[model samples]
Target: MAPDQTNSADVLIAPAPGPGALRHRLEEAILGDIASGRLAPGTALPPSRTLADALGISRWVVTEAYGHLVGKGVLEARTGSATRVAAVAPVAVPDGAARRVAPAPRLERAPDRATHDLAPGVPDLRHVPRDAWLRAAREALAGATNQDLGAQPPAGHPAARAAVATHLRRSRIVSGPDDAVVLTRGAADGMSRIAAALATAGHTHLLVEDPSWAALRDAAAAAGLTPVPVPVDDAGISPGRLRAEAARTGARAALLTPAHQFPLGAALPDERRAALLDWAREVDGLLIEDDYDAEFRYDRRPVPALQGLDPDRVLLLGSTSKTLAPAFGIGWMVVPQRWRAPVLDVSVRRGPAPGPATLDQLTLARFVGDGAYARYLRAARARYARRRAALLTALERELPGARIGGIAAGMHVTVDLAGVRVGPAGAGGDDAAVVDGRDGVDAAAADFAALDAAAVVREGAARDVALVDLRRYQAAPSARSTVLVVGYGNLADARLPAAIRGLRAAVEAASAEAAGAGAGAARAGPTGAAAGSVG
Candidate 1:
């Protein structure tokens, strides 16, 4: 057992030969070392030639073993870097042990510190416009008046509101007076205020998109409003379904990501928009529009803000979480004139406004007014476009059968693994379970065994690739698809191929595990079977 020569500091013990093909033995030994934590995640391995020479084996044997492990995502190799153990590895389980389900991942938590994180809603922090931001901060501080440093109005500083109003009008086609703009810490903060206002207005039920961003649901619940999930589809939330849900649940307020629906990524068409507006007007309901990442649309010009169609019924929310960085802590809501006082009152009751410091708000005002923000967006769009292209290419090569959704725009895409036919009883077969009219898929129709999303997530995590199961966002179990919301915003273009390959390995493993489980269930008698039969 000698240390590797390439990186003299890191040690590598030569694996002993066993009774099998040299390559098989070598592969097994390496896997054993990795499983035993002797070759820890990210530990560099000796060059194949060095290991082969030291072990008195053919160099080809070592190379084949290393290649096999790389294909399995147990290791990673870069052109200019040494072959090393993957950043994430599967936890070792005893023989005959059952696999445990992983807990659903949260959207607000920062992604795990991993080699590749594909968690939805994470933005690329590397490209933040430091220079322009610093310039704006300096100008804001230099021009600050004593009043600017004092307690500010609940509606935000006049200059900042004016700047935001102008930007929304020019960019999102959301027209409103500066007074309509109410600043808050971020979209989450704005949502809280809106929820409180809805609660105060005697609204007990709020209509929400099924499989929507989880934070909005949390906000509505915190305000003592029950959230009733309305199904979404390829054309965005169906107006008919929403109307029906609202009528049944007596929900008078709804939150939507109409520009591009979060997770599933469907832009609401003009027709659906009109219908939704009509429904809102008929019910005298309120609509909260979260325009979280509208600025990053690559396929075409971004969809116009839903609020622009009828500002009186739509409270448009925008945040710098995506375009800039979450650390900026700035967001705005274009409130309806009638509800402005109620929202502000709720803000006051909650104590002092929880918005960013006045100086930071003023700096954003300057940033937007000086044309710096536009230039930054131009650069960011191109950067993200390239990263997105890389991710799509990798998925095409690695997982050809994966049905990709939400690729037209947004920070993430939905990968439907259940659409992939793995065997005779594979998903999307005649027996495929479908959710009734939910996202245009049958929920109870699957005849095949359900693929465990937890298994897929666990496998991806083992390879140091963070993934979010789409089921995490669902208010109810409505479908059998093991869909994953894969975010590429935080991932580097250079790493996409390896990350996707690792994900492919995870999907294949999960598919095989599911097929095996299905077979076992078929063989089991009624007495041997589990009590519950999930569709």
Candidate 2:
């Protein structure tokens, strides 16, 4: 029943109370009503006389019950108005069922105790233009109608899709509206939809970049699709390797980060991009292009999206998480004609892809159409460029000879620790962890790098410097080593130097510990064994 139509009198029941238990029965009934949402906040209760006549109970019994509930804070009575359910009354929710949904931002924030945050993918929220956003929001709210708040069609709001279409065409060289654009909660959510659609079409395997973002692999798995890791190189995902993997695994779709590869930050070269598209075309497969963080290109002009190259064979997934703020659950996918029906089917059943609030979608529509988004991007690009510069400078000054790459774009930089020694001397051996059964890197060497990175991370944590080791981004346990993914987006210029300085000190301490262990092993080598009882 509609909330407005649920009559308070209709919900009440006549009770057969025994031995002075009338008040207890009435209280239980009212509590159940509130718990089940029958007695909604601000909903007026029935007049004492009316309820007494219906229930055939004493009016004072009803009034006493009401008065008792008011005392318990379950109901409230104003001087001239009827008693109503208290706005803050606690509901007796089922176990494990939340009465309220807690909000979690797509971006991560440093813990309160942390002094510095170098974690990657976190945006500097200070960059959000509050005045512009508020203006857009107010405009959207003022223009909304009662019908706008009603059940919307499955595809999405028309204004939002149209706005997204215009934005894509102008910024990414992609075009389409209404039917072409499929709204999602975020990039991961888009991947799940695509994966589900592909699975429904009888394709169960997806090719994802090795050492890629874990979310891509996880989303595919959640959609009942197996993720096969295809190794990546400086140019981007190795097209040759990907083709071979697809052939072996019968994967009909490949998820890629062509514009700016996550954690690795390599723009797919023109030739590789062409090769990838050719592979997709030949196999009659699909490419899920995660166009995340492509707008903040620092070294050169942004690369055109892979979906723009061949929209029919590529599904472009882009989100406002990086460009605007992660809190706004707004993202879009440019779907091909062939997959539109199935894609829309799954998305609609999910009930509002990304399930964005109506006001958010409208505000985003206005923000994009009015050029406020572009202006914000331009200003943010400048700010991130400066932060990236500061981080690089700090790294160079504090830890010379460390190799940092993938800095041309994206919010994070990759620090290669191949040359750094992090374990005891004796721990160095010939074996290395091979990524994708390809690169025969020394396992011990990678361990040493991981140890070094861990020590630095621990010291940073103790000192309130929040940083992460690069290994965390790898999908498989042995997929990567010898690197630290340093995100500079969350740190300020003044704090970069100090954080880097602490990181260097931690590294030195770890080196000393390793060296001392090696020396102790050397001292114990001869004495620990009985001098040749040649057994």
Candidate 3:
């Protein structure tokens, strides 16, 4: 509340008591006073009936408000001592900026959601055919070889290796498979192997992608390789820049996701693909091709695996991150003949441990070899198609004009909101409703705000309908509006509409809040002038 000419800043909103109005207003006023410190925490509030008479409001209204406060523990309403605030410190206001709402909070926490969860890499669970899995499990236990289960095998399951080799040759059309496939954990395991191999190859630097997976950048640095970022555009990293960077840093290997790039969602094009292979051939450098989530193509026909084009230069890496399950931890690295020993040696130095448990490998091999893997792949493709369609439709309806980026292949997609306007409170908060129009958040500024979250990434976790405050995945500090990287993997088709409704509610509430805050600040600032502002 801002004072008009008299330099007084006080706002009192008390509705006349007709029925419930008095009770509501009184409660609001009491809470407001307690929050603003007009009525100090320890101060005794007037007894219900007595205060009601004095204030000309009904005795029950005053009692009701006091009762409400007492319930909140704001008032003790003790048997002897006067009503007092609870001993506990002031907790965060609901949906208010009192605490941090980051990665997980902003993420929709419900698991066990979605039918065709095709937001990239998640395999069709329908393919599991529970009955088959159960049978395989029984068989695995019955036929348990004398292999130690206390620690993992250095080389993965011989049967799994053989199965993978057979699958690769038939499906990916790779050449001979009568060689070593040192399995560690997953693709991540392979990356570690490559990192170690590159270090021993006497290469001090690793050429990287600009908008690549955050994991790759971390892996390179962990392996003692300087990650020299090579900016990637649609065609993938310009071959010219790749050559220059490799020459500049003597980069030993380039970690890439050619078939389907991460984050930016670029599927490597023909010319660039050939040029990249040429660069590797010319420099005798290694290319770690992450063929992680290439199986779930929706909009276009499946792109051919790059490893088939140049087997020697490209160490094709594959994982079950999207195929089976992340928990299964099944992955493999296919190294060229000469580098096979070095790859295995690096794995040994790093305590080469096979990931997917022997039992799991046995099960997966059964799943794959029994033609169920292909069946699940086909099923997953269909489910993801629906999920993708739902996402596109929602964006089209709610956030019209949002530039949907990324190759229409994968579990996640990005929406660029450069043209739209979104504020800090999000679309569902009412903080801005009290603003008097100047420009700021006085209510927030006067009391508290945790760390300035403007520095972190948010909203890229899972797809939600209410995306008003989703600015997490956007390039930082540009104020390029708010972009949302939505993962459709977790949403059930039936629940999406409700999610969109939630998004709208969040944004609408946010708008009202912003207005109110602006108004409230204007009523209380700059020596009682109309100096209110809200963000």
* Number of backbone collisions per candidate: 13, 6, 47
lDDT by residue (1-535, candidate 1, tens digit) is 3323345123434443324576776666677676666677777887876665344456798889889889888888898778887888553432211111122465766644566778878777655777689899999999999989889778888999999999999999997799999999999899999998888889999899997988888988998899999999988898889888888989988999999898799898899989889888998888899999988899898889999999999999989998887888899999999999998898787666557788999999999999999998887788778778888887766665677898468788988775453322323345432221222222222233456677889988898988888888899864554788999877755456678877877776676665556546555534566446443
For model 2, state the Cα shift of residue 178 in Å. 4.6
Best by TM-score: 1
TM, every model: 0.74, 0.72, 0.64
Ranking 2 against 3 by TM-score, winner:
2
- Runs of candidate 1 exceeding 4 Å displacement: 1-112, 419-450, 519-526, 529-535
Residue 414 alpha-carbon offset, candidate 2, angstroms: 0.4
Q: How many backbone clashes does candidate 2 have?
A: 6
- Choose the strongest candidate by lDDT: 1
* Cα lDDT, all candidates: 0.78, 0.73, 0.61
The window of 10 residues in a row where model 1 has the poorest summed lDDT is 94-103
Q: Hey, what RMSD does candidate 1 come out at? A: 12.4
lDDT of 2: 0.73
Model 3 worst lDDT run, 10 consecutive residues? 2-11
* Stronger candidate by lDDT (2 vs 3): 2
Error of 2 at 302 (Å): 0.4
Let me know the TM-score candidate 3 reaches against the reference structure: 0.64
Provide the RMSD of all predictions against the true structure, rounded to 1 decimal: 12.4, 17.5, 17.3
